[model samples]
Structure formats: C-alpha cells, structure tokens
Target chain A: MGDLFTDTIVISVLAATIRIATPLILAALGELIAERAGILNLGVEGTMLMAAFAAFIGAYATGSTLMALLLAVLAGMAMSFIMVFMAATLKVEQVVTGLALNLLAAGMSLYLYKAFFAVEGQAMPTVAVMPVAPIPFLSEIPYIGPILFTQKVLTYVALLMVPVVWFFLYRTKYGLEIRCLGENPKAIDTKGMSVSLRQYGAVMAGGALCGLAGAFVTIGSSARFVPDITNGRGWLALVIVIAANWRPSGILIAALVFAFLDALQLQIQGIGVQMPYQIFLALPYVLAIVLMVLKSRRGRSEEPARLGVPYFRGER
Target chain B: MGLRLEPRLAPSARWQAVSVAVALLAALAVSALLLESAGTDVGVAFAAILDGAFGGLRTTAKTLAKATPMILTGLAITVAFRAKVWNIGAEGQLFAGAMASYWLYTLTGPALGMALLPLLFAAGFVGGGLYGGLAGWLRSAFRVNEVLTTVMLNYVILYLLSFLLVGPWRDQSSFYQQSERIDRAAWLPDLWAPGKLHLGFLVAILAAVAIHVVMNRSWFGYEVKAVGLNARAARFKGINVERTAVAVMVLSGGLAGLAGMIQVFGVNHRLESDISLGFGFTGIIIAVLAMLRPGWVVFVAILFGGFENGGIKMQVATGAPSAIVSAIEAITLLFFLTAAALTRFRIVWRST
Candidate 1:
C-alpha cells in the first residue's frame, strides 16, 4: 500500500510536468524558428502577453475556447509582425525594437483591461477554464497514461510540434532556406530570393506558435486574466532555446527540465512544505543563469553564425 | 525600384533635428487617434496632460520631482550602452539599493541622525553595484551573455525582496508587503514648498555632470568607447575588454541604485515594491532616443516625467487609463528609432 501511494504521487508530479511544459515548448519552438532565420526576436515575452490578453478577452466575450485560441494566434502574429517589420525593412536595432514591443504590450494590455474588463460593484470577471480531455483507452493505463495521455489538447499539440518542427527544419526545402538566411543571407540574395520575405514568413509563423503558448496561460487553465500573468515564462522559453542548442529535441528536454522544476514546486507548495514559497519561485531563473553559463562553457555548439545581425545585400 | 536609399556621407544635422521633431509630432498624432477611438476626448486629454505637467510652479515642480529618478536611471543606461554593454537588470539593481539602504537605516536606528544620509547612499550604491557586478563577472568569466544573466537577476532579486517583505521585514502595523518607514531625519531636504520636490533633482544633475566628465574627458571613457566600437580591436590595442565590461556595469548599476535610494528617501519615504514604477525600463527608451548622450537624457527624462504626471491627471479628467503614457513613450521610441535610421540615408528615385 505504501509503494502504491508513492507511485501515485510520482505519477501525479510527472503528469503535472507534461501539462506545464505546454507553453514553454510552443514558445521555444517558435523562438527557434525566428533565430534560425537570423532575427533575434526578443519580443517573445510581449507577444505572449498580448496573445494571452486577447485570448482572455475572446474567451470571456464569446465563451468559446476555439475562438479564444484563434484570437490569441492572431494577436501573436500581429505583435511579431511589428518585430519583423522594424527589423527587416528598416534594419532597426533588434534589441531596442524588441524592448519597445514588450513595453507597448505591458501598457496596452493593462490599459485595455482597466478600460473594458472591470465592472462596478463586482469582483473581477472570470471565464470558465477549458475542461481536460482524457483520451479513450489511452488515459486508462496505470502510469504513462495519467502522466502523458490525459492532458488538454494543447499539450498534445505542443508535444507533436517537436517532431513536426524537426521535420520542417531538416527535411524541407523552405527550412533549409530559412537556415541559410541565418548562416549566409547573401546566398539566398544571390539566388534572387528575397531575404526579407523569408524572414517575414519565418517570424510570423513563430509568432503564431507563440500565440498558442500564450493562450494556454489563461484560457486553458486560469479562469481570469492577470496582468503580466505569463510572468517570466516567455523569457524562460528564450533561455530554453539557447540551452537546447537550437534543436527541436534539445528544446523538448530543456523545456521538460524547467517544467519539472515548476511542477515539483507546485507539489511542494501543495503539501505545505516548511519553506518560503519565494525560494521555489526563484529556482527557474537562478537555474537559467547556471544553464547558460554551462552551455557557454561546453564545446560543439550549434549557435547561428549571424543570429542577431541584420542582413544587407551589399555588405561584405 | 520606385525609391531607394543612398547612404549619407554626413547626415545633415538640420534634417536629423527636423525628422526627430516630426517623429514626436507623429507619435502625439497617433496617441490622439487612439484616445479618440477609445471614446476619450483628445482635446481634454492633451489639455489635461499639459495642465498637470506644467500649468503652475507646483505642477512643474512635481514634474521635475518625477523626472529625478528617471534622470539617474537614464544616465545609468547611457553610460553602459555607450560601451554597448546591455544591463537590463537596472530594475533589479534599483530594488537592491532600496533594500540595502533601508536595512542599513533600520540597523543604525537613526542614531547617526542626518549623518546617516550619506551612509545610506553609499550602501545603496554598493548594493546595486554588487548586484550588477555579478552579471558582469559572469560575462567576463563564463562568456555568458549579460542580457540573459541580468534579466534573470532582475526576477531573482524581486523574489528575494518579496520574501524579505513578507517574512523578516514585514510591517506589522500595516497590511502590505513593505518595511517600516525610515527615520524623518534621513528624509531628503525639501527643495521647494510649492511641490514635494527634494534634493534628488539636484543630485541627478550633479551625477549627469560627473558622468559627462567621466565619459568624455577621461581615459577610462575612451577605453569604454573603444571596446564598444569593436571589442577585438580594443583587445588588440591592449585594452582589457572583459575588465572594462565589468567596470561599465558596476558604474551603471551604481547609478541605478542611487536612483532607487533617492526614490525611497526623497519621494516614497519608505521602501515598497511599487516604489519603482518601471523607471528602470523607461530609462532604455530615454537613453536610446537621446542617442545615448548624457546631456540629452535629462531633457528626455523631464519630458517623460511630464508625461507621467500628465497621465495621472488625464486619467482623472477623462475615463482613460493612465497607462497611455507608457504606450506613448513606447510609440515615441519606435518612431524615433525609425527617424534615426532614416537620417542615415537619403531617398532616391529609380527609373524602372
């Protein structure tokens, strides 16, 4: 009986791990695409915030999870479009552009929330969180089923994207061209293909994926929207991409590591451990710095040659 | 191509100034449109903002008071950015300074009287400097990117502050996550009776002047510039790039820390989580639009400071949320960056 109890606890923690990894996976994969295309879009945090706000608004207004998801994806894409436009067309400094987008989102989202959401003499309005979908026959298994198969639809999509993204990056022609843009954009320019166009495509696609990640933050789990609710998760995804060495499978493992830490913290807090919860909250950020230091020390890296540099057709 | 850009050998100063003016005007136009669309009267909002920002000596003093922290933070950014060392952790460093100075004040229990003021400022500078120095050390020792490390530190310190606020430092009489007020003896001397302006404004200016001297008239400033222009070239020229990076961050973080210390003693009179209203982040916009020039930072910070006060008044006069100021700040930044980029090239028409 004791063994069974321990087994159940372990399975529960692992299950929570899969569930929490959803947003990180989606956002990091999106970041990977953008980085592969030579645009270091550090605006992922802002994009996620905008998408999360949009999803909350959509879900609250229409009471449709699908509609919320669509709105979120659109919001994400719109935010990223700004990043691509400023970075590609004007060749503005990507770092400053990214910072501007994040600040814009912070102000706009709060302004909209205050202006539209709050009602007089009422508690904060909330929408119904999405119901979990347990797969037939698959969710009945003892350990693995509860841990992996019985999650929200977005979790499955996030996991499935690992392979899909891998295939797109390695076996596909467009993926090859996108990678080439980062490595040597002049090659694509010499071939008469528009470097700017390819960057636009890659970044927008990444933004759409980020939209999904953001949607999961509020519509999928929480009943109401909170300002800066994504918190540092979006930034964590950026760290995961670097720690993953810019590979789909590596991202999967790195994301799981972060998710597991979060899941374990939740469980620890649930059991009412005798420690400050703030310490648990601070772990991932602390670990992110450690991971980056370690990654920098290691050999055989896969960093893009010209990751943050803007391309010029005539430049040497 | 219908139109193309040709690089300007020397971008005309007159055109740069004109374009920047047009960009600010355009940002205002966009803000007006946004307000109109949001069911707010553009006229009332702008007028209210102007009145709140500069209508009288009191409001004008308040605006300058508001700009005090920003000037320091803006200079902090300008100093580091001039060396191309990105220190995104100024927000965190600011908090570190506040917490450290407060802790010192509590320990000393105002026994030192007004003499404690300089000690608190020193503690703040050291607190923020050490926090910033960690990221610098990481960059120099581990080749870790300062951007990520500094950002992570920002989040980490907030949690630390949160813990201290709720656990050890919690104000028992009050219900918020903040510490007890500092001794009145340590409060900044009031500059004017019209508004609650304090000595912090003068300090910010003095800092700017000191920074102007350090950055332009000193050999260390030249080393920083060389490293920013090209690290490899600087190293080849016998400059220690890594050490310079650490020194730049220390200076940047120290100034940001001073901003935090001043906010507590001069404005808030107590250290709380909300003491900093994203002043550190806004410094980036100010520094960038100022073209990383310290002289321009003060003027830009004052303009933004006016926006802050005006935003509150506008929110009261109209139903619009005061966050519009932040949005406008960002819009101005985007437009200014574009205008700066545009100034580098002249439009050329091509025959197809």
Candidate 2:
C-alpha cells in the first residue's frame, strides 16, 4: 500500500508517460496527414525505422545531436520519396509498396549496422542522449511541472504539433485542398490543382515528422541503438492513427493512452509486480485491437474516402 | 502533350520475361555495389553465393533445408494475397502452430504412438488457422484493418510465446527459454539418408503443388478470385464475400502453421524464438517476386535460400554481414514491381 501507488511513483510514471508519448504523437500526426491526403502510407513503420537508424548512425559518426536529427529527417524524406513515387507516380499497389519499404529498411539498416559499426564486435558505441530541457519557471511547479515541463525538446514539439496540425488541417487553404484530395481527388483535378503534387507534399511532410519521431526514439531517449530498437512503436502509431479517427486531438489522447500503458508497465516491472512482465509488454497491442473494435462502433468516422486508392486523372 | 500511358489490352509474355530479367540484373548489380562498398570483393562474394548454393550435394541439401520454411510461408502468402486478404501475421501464425503442436505432443505423446506425428501436424494447422481466423473475423465483423491487426497480432503472439517458454515450458537442463528436446521417435524421417534433406521438404513441395491445383482448378479458388477482383460484384453474383475472406485466411494460416510445426519436428527439434528470422516478411517478397504464382514460389524461395546460405559463408570468409542477402531480396522485389508496372503500360507520345 505504501509503495505501488505512492505520490512519488505516480509523478514519475506520469512523467515517463509524456516522454514515451512524444514519438507516438509525432508519428500518428504524420500518418494522419498521409491518410488525409488519400495516401495510406503503411510504410510509416519502415520510414521510422530508416530514420531511427539514420539518426543513430549520424549521431555516432558526427557526434552532433542536431546533425543526427537532420539526417533522420532526410532519411525519412528519402523513404517517402520512394513511397510517393510508387503510389502517386507508378501507381503500384500501395500496400505492397509500403511493405517493400518496410522490408527494405529492415534489411538495409541491419546490413549497414553490421557492416559499418558492429563489425568489430567490441564495445557498443554510445551516443550523447538528448539532455532534458526543463522550462524555466514552469519546471519549478509541483507535480504538473515535473510531468510536463521536464522533457526533451522534441517532447514539447510533439505536443505543440497537435494544435499546429489541427490548424493546418482545418483552417488553411492548402489543407483544404489536401483534404479534398482524399475525399475527392477529381474535385481538385477538375479545379486545375495538381492532386499528385499535393499528395507528394503531404506525404513528404508527414514523412519528415515521422523522421523526427524516429529521431526521438534514438537521439532523444536512448544512448545506443539496438537491433529492432523501435520494435512495434511504429506499428503502435498506426493503431493510434486509426483509434484517433484520423484527427489530431484524438491522436494526442490515443497516444497518451498507449504511452501510459507503456509507462505503467515499466513502473509495475520496476516495483516487482507478481505477474510476468510479458503480460505487461503485450498490453498495448492487445488494447490496440480492442480500441479498433471500439472505433468501428462509432459511425461517421472521418476516414478519407480515397485512402489507399491511387488517383489517376480522368478516371472516375 | 508530350507523353501518355496507354494500357496494353493484354501484356505480352515476351515483355514480362524481358522485364523480369532486367529487374534481376539491376537488383544483382546493386547487391554487387553494396558488397564492393563494404570492402568485400564483389567477384568473390558472387562466386561464393553460387558455390555455396550449388557447389556440391552437401551444400545443395543445406539450401533446400533453408528453403523449406520459406516455401511454406510463401505459399501461405500466395493463398491469402490471391483473394486480396493481406494476412501479414504468418510470423505469429507460425509460432502458434509450433506451440500448439508442442503442447499436443507433450500431452498425448505416450498414448498416441505412430499417430503422434500426423496429429501434431494437424494440431499445428488448426492452431495457425484459428489464429488467422481471428484476424479475418475482426476484419469482416468489426471493419478492423487486417494489415494493422495482423501486424499487432504478430507482436502479441511473440510475447505470448516468450511467456510460455519462460514459465511453463522452460527446459531445466538448458538456461535458455525453450522447451525440452522433442522425442527422437517424433523426428521427421530424412528424405535422403546421406543428405540433410528431410521429409519436410517433400511436404513443402506437396503443399506448393496442392496450392497450385486449388488456386487454379477449384471452385473455391474461383470464388476467392471473384471476391478479390471485385467484392461488390462478387456479392451481387451470389458469392458470400465475407465468408470467402475468412476461409481464405484459414487456408493461408494453416499453411504457415504447418511450416512452423515442421521446423520444430524436422529441423530444430525444439520450439524456440529463432524459428522465424523474419520469414513471414521475407515470404511477402518471395510471393510478390514470383508474381503471386505457386509454381514460381518454390523457384524463388530456393533462389533466396541460396542467397541466405551463401551470405553466411561470405560472412565467414570476407567478414561481410550476412544481412546483404535480405537487402538484395528486397531490392529485387522493388525493382521487379517497378518493371512490372513499366511492362504493363506502353508509353505513347501524344500531340494535341
């Protein structure tokens, strides 16, 4: 009674929650933009993996966290370039193309890791993990301050992105055009706007955000890159996008929910819970399926009509 | 207007053959570049791959042994993708099969004598089929995306397997989280006594042949194709689209589960995590590169099997990472898909 649910533990768990949610929020918002633009980039996981690996390698080589972040973003964009090129230009099956990117990343990352760094089989190279940037006055506040203010810079950016993404999706003209591309690409094509061009833009931008998400997984949180470091976090973000119903605010809630489970799992394991840790490890994915079932019950979902269907001008 | 794409009424066989060849050459060229960049001699690596694949009878047997599980997973993918049902949980389904078969063997191994092996295989099939059925039901009933659900299920089953291995099934003798070595009587008989080729390879070949016939000649096959081509039209034509989708998943999952069970009974002789080294994902590449044809699946799987076996040898000799093979396989699929798109369309210069 004095240990598990104590005030100190609660605060630490909540703080961990925010830190874990950072990448999910970034990736989910990125996926949201792609879904809105009528491109279902199932390659988000692959895009994130490539970026995470790129960020890790960059950090190790250049010894600059900023350069690592930039490298990750560029890697994310490069992967999305292939995704958009295949989906928008070549019109290959979107699902297959996305899977190809995933497999490609899985193989290429492991190959490069082994060839470049792991060849020695000596000490695992470490990077300077992002220093936590606490807000000046806000960080001094009580429980709330530690939970929210004391976080990496990317964590704050992830939170701020929710509103920024909301504004861009709902308020701006280009956002309107992008949304129109998802619901009715023919409408944009008829009005003399390039549907594919906007799709490329939306997907590439979303990819950049996923890059940042990937960067956070490495340079932001951990000091060393492990094989399959992102694990299923990338997939979890896809689930969050669906649970969020493709909305930004909903995405933040859904991400925090999943991240909370992760944080709680970490805390419970730390306290030496009686149950096997694998059960806790498996909870988020189980909940993801449950959340999807709940999502399906809610009618009038905002899923884009043309999502996953490639647009060809003049085709009904 | 400069250039336009005009759909070919029916793509010529020659164009397809040429495109595939070009895709292969380009993919191998990239692999060569990767090897050279890694400080490995390109010519030696390529020669090593070919020699390791088919240098002698012993090497060829190893390649076939390596290809066995992939062939099954490849067939699993072919069955599901044929009906446009993306069941990406072959990895999880494989584990479920292994666990189920192992559980059944431990429970009834003494009572069931000769019937043990067949029953274990059946248990594996049922186990995998049911796991796949769950995803199918979720997709059909709840409108959950099969891709996402299947992917999640893969991770869930892995954790589940990890829990079982550590808790209930941990072998006391060894420190690893794995089961006791299976009974010697339960081992699959070797197809070639002198070689490493086992009866499991025969089963994979048989599965491939069965899948080819079912996909091409059966009425259920027609229903699956109809549903995949156009679900709405298939429904209008009196086909139960949802049920077909579920059935497709069951059949696909059964094949993958069988692969996992065979890996346990035939190859490793124990249940372990390393049973699947991204075989499910690699199966996707194999199925696609084969153009989703069962006959081609066997050929492509063997080719990849050679790369895997060769890459390991190259690593020993040249210190290059064995991961180059997987990278090469993925690059091939991407290039092939691009070439397929190019061949499917004929470019026309338009002047308006």
Candidate 3:
C-alpha cells in the first residue's frame, strides 16, 4: 500500500509537470524558429498576450475550443506580419521592433478589454475549459497510463510538434535555407534567394506557434482572459530558446525541466512548505538565470553568429 | 542582363519622415479596425484621447509632470546607447534608487534628517549609480552580455523589492500594502495649487540642459559618441573604451535612479509597486523618437508624458481604458523604430 501510494504521487506530479510545460514548449518552439531565422522577436510577449485575448474572445463567442485555437493562431500570425514589415522589409532592429510589439500587444489588449468590459468590479463569465481525453487502452493502466496519455488535444499537438519541428529543421530544404540565412545572410543573399522572404516566413511560423501557445492559456488552461495575463511567459520562452541553444529537441527538454520546477513550486505550496510563496514565484526565473550562467561558463553557449543585426545586402 | 543598384550609405530624411507618417497611419488604421469590431466609433475614441491630454491647463501641467521622470530615464538610455552599452535594466536600477531613497527617508524622515532632502537625493543618486555599475562590472569583467545581465538583474531586484515590501517594509497602518510614508520634510513641493506637478519638472529641464552640454560640447561626451559609432575605431584613436562604457552606464543608472527618487518624493510619497509605472521602458521609446539626442529627448519626453498624463484623465472621463493610451505608446515606439531604421537604410527594389 505504501509503495503504491508513493508511486501514485510521483506519477501524478509528472503528469502535472507535462501539463504545465505544454505552453512553454509550444512558445519556445516558436522562438527557436524565429531565432534560427536570425530575427530575435522580442514581441513574443505581445504576441502571446494578443493570442490569449483572441483565444478567449473566440472561445467566449463561439463556445468551440477548436475555433478559439484557430483564431488565436491567426491573431499571432498577424502580429508576426508586423515584425515581417519592420525587420524583414524595412530592416529595423529586430529586438527593438519585437519589444515595441510586445508593448503594443499589452496596451492594445488591455484597452480593448477596458473599452468593452469596464465594469467597476464585476467579474466576466468564464468560457468552457479544454476537455481532457484519455487514450482508450493506455488510460486504463494503473500508473503510467493517465500521466502520459490523458490530456487536452493541444498537449498532444505540442509533444508531436517537437519531432515534427526537428524533422523539418534538419531534413527539409526550406529549413536548410533558414539555417543558412541565419548563419550567413550574405552567403544566402549571393545564392539569389531573398534573405528577407525566408526570414519573414520563419517569423510568421514562430508567430503562429506563439498564438497557439497563447490560446492554450485562455481556452486550454484557464478558459478566461485576464489583463496582462501573458505576464512574463513570453520572455521566459525567449530564455528557454537560448537555454536550449535553438535546438527544437532541446527546447522540449528545457521546457519540461522548467515546467517541473514550476510544478514543484505549486506542490510545495500545496503541502504547506514553510517558505514564502513569493520566493517560489521567482524560482523559475532564478533557475533560468542560473542555467544561463552555468551554460555560459561551461562554454557550451551556441549562439548564431549574426543573430540580431539587420541584413543590408551590400554592407559588410 | 540586369543592372545592379548600389546601396546608399544613408537614407534620406524624406524617407524617415514618410515612414513616420506611414507608421502612424498604420497604427491608427489597425486601432480603428479593432474599435470597429468592438462596435465603437474610432473618432470619439481618439478625440477622447486628445481632450484628456490637452483639454485644460491642469491636464497640460499634469502632462509635464508625467514627462518629468521620462527626461531622466531617456537621458539614461541615450547616454549608455551612445556608448553602445545596452542597459535594459534601468527599471531595476530605478527600483533600487527608490528603495534607497525610501530607506534614507525612513531613517531620517522624522529626525534630524528633516532638513536633509538634498542629502537624501544624493543618496538616491549614488544608490542607482552603484546598482547600474554592478551590471556594468559584471559585463566588463566577465564578458557577460549586458542585455542578459540587465534583464536578469531586473527580476532579482524586483524580487528583492517584493520581499522587502511584503515583509519587513510593509506599512503598518494603511489598507494599501506599501512602505511607510516619509515625513513631510522629505516630500517634494507641488509647483502649482491644483495640479500635482512638482519641483521634479524643473529638475528634468535642468538635467536636459546639463546632458545637452555634456553630450555635445564636452570631450567625455564626444568620446562616448565616438565609441558608439565605432568601438574599435574609437580605441584606435587612443580612447579608453571600457572606462567610457563604465562611466556612461554609471551616469545612466544614476539618472534613472533619480527618476525613481522623484516618484517617491514627488508623487507617491511612499514606496509602492506602481512607483515607476514602466517609465524606464517608455524612456526607450522617448529616446528613439528623439533620435538619441539629448535636446530632442526634451520635446519627445513632453509629448509622451502629456499623452500618459492625459490618458489617465481620459480613462476617468470617457471610461476608455487607460490601456488605449499605452497601446498608442506602443504603436508610437514601433513607428519610431521603423522610421529610424528606414532613415538609416532603404532598399530599392529592382528586378535583377
């Protein structure tokens, strides 16, 4: 009985860990694509915020999780189009443009919320949360079944996208072009391919993924929109991209590790740990910083050569 | 068979001006679509913004008041940027400065320190500079990127402040969770009777002039700008690039810190979460719009400040959410960045 109880608790925690990591994994994957394309979109935060809002609004209006997710993805792609215009077409500093987009996302979303729902202190109705479905035979198994198999459709998509992204990035021609441009835009430019077009494509891909991640927050997780709800997760996603060194597979592992840490915080709080909740709230960020420092110290830092600079074809 | 076009070294000012106009129109068009979808008139919404910002003398003064700290934060970014030292952690440093000022006032507010507002301000300046210098030292010594260090330090400082405020520093009497209010002696005097505009406005103007002189006329300023333009080239000319970087960051952090002190003394009069209101981030926008020039920062800062100040009034009156103003700000920053980029580099499309 004792062994069974301990096994159950561990499995349960791992299941919770997967649930928490899903959004981060999705968002980080998007960031990986953007960074791999040599455009560091700092506006991931804004993109996520807008996605979250769009997801909530869609879910609330249509009452269909699928529709909400779709709208959220479109909203995210739209946001990325702005980055495309700024970084790819106009050749602005991608980092600054991304940062501005984030600010714009937050401000615009909040304004829309206020303009519509400016009730003094009334709460808005929450939409239906994402439904969980368990795999037929696997879910019936004692410990391993529910932990791995039973989750929202989005979770499965997130896990599946990991290998899909890996395959696309490594085996595909378009992915090769992206990697080539990131490594040396001048070389890619010489190949008679428009470096700008490839970059715009990559950023849009990332933006769509980020939108999915944001929709997950509203429809899949909370089923309600809150102002500034994206908080700093978008930034965290950026850090995860770096910590994973722009590897899609590594992004999966990093996302799980960070999510486990986040889950641990909640478990500790649930079990009445003596420490302050604020410390736990800050633990994930602290961990990311420590991981970055450790990774940098070990000289295992793998950064693309010309990551943040705009490519002006003739300039050296 | 195709003629290749030579890339221009510099984009014409005409492109920049047009880009700015295009960006604004784009932002407005996007915002209008959002409003239309929500079933609101775009005209009424924008009019509300203009009126809230400049409808009255009281509002204009309020706008200047809002712009006050922006001048300092804008200068902080402009200085470090000119030296090519990315100091995104000004928000963290600003928090540290406010905390330091709070500490000073807490210790001296009720006692002999009643006559020491100037001393307290000095302490605030030193505190912000030191915090900024910490990131600088880490980068210069360890070759750690300032971007990462500054970003990390922001979280660390935020947590530290949270720990202090929620635990040891919590005000005992108030319903609102914040630090103990400083004695009246440490409080900044309002410049006018009705408006909340304080002595901080004058200080912002004076600092702008000081920065103008230091950036344009002074050798130190020239050295900083030279390093920004080309670090290796500046080093070739016998300039101590590292020292200049450190000095500019320290000065930059100090100015940001002073903005925090002004908030604590002038507006809030107590340390709270809303003390800086993301002024540090907004300063980046202000600096960009001003084209990183100290003189231009003044005009840009006031415009942004006016919008923010008026934004609050608009929020109160039209019930238009304050986030609308922030959206405008975000759009404005995006536009300015794009404009700057277009001015610096323009691509001519010709099929080769």
True contacts kept of each: 0.76, 0.82, 0.62
Native contact share for candidate 3: 0.62
DockQ order, best first, reads 2, 1, 3
Residue pairs whose backbone atoms clash in candidate 3 = A43-A98
Measured with C-alpha atoms, the lDDT of residue A254 in candidate 2 is 99
Candidate 1 per-residue lDDT, tens place, A121-144, comes to: 679999988888999999999898
Per prediction, the TM-score for chain B is 0.98, 0.97, 0.93
Interface RMSD of each: 0.9, 0.6, 2.0
- Model 2 is docked with a DockQ of 0.87
In the range A1-316, model 2's lDDT, one tens digit per residue, is: 6864588899999999999999999999998998899998989888999999999989999999899999999999999989988898778999999899988888898898888888584988889999999999999998899999999999999999999999999999989999998899999999888788899999999999999999999999898887778898889998999899889999999999999999999998888879999999989999999999999998789999999998876685
Best by DockQ: 2
Q: Per-residue alpha-carbon lDDT of model 3 for A1-316, expressed as tens digits?
A: 9998778668878888889888898899998888888887888888999999999888888998888999999999999999878887777767667767877887888888777764678887688999998988988887777887988888999999999888888899998888877789998899898898899899999999999999888788895678888767787788788778789888988999988988888888887978867787777877776666665666555677778777887777
- Interface CA root-mean-square deviation for model 1: 0.9
Can you write out model 3's per-residue Cα lDDT over B1-352, one digit (the tens) per residue? Answer: 4433344577677877898888778777876676567665667767776776677898888888888889889988888887878888788888888888788777766565446767767777787888898778766655556766677677777888888887889988877768887777677777884868898888878888999999999999999989989999999999987778778878988898889999988888889978888888888778877878988998988888877866676566555566666777788787667666656754556674
**Candidate ordering by TM-score (highest first):** 2, 1, 3
True-structure RMSD for candidate 1: 1.5
For every candidate, C-alpha RMSD to the true structure in Å: 1.5, 1.5, 2.8
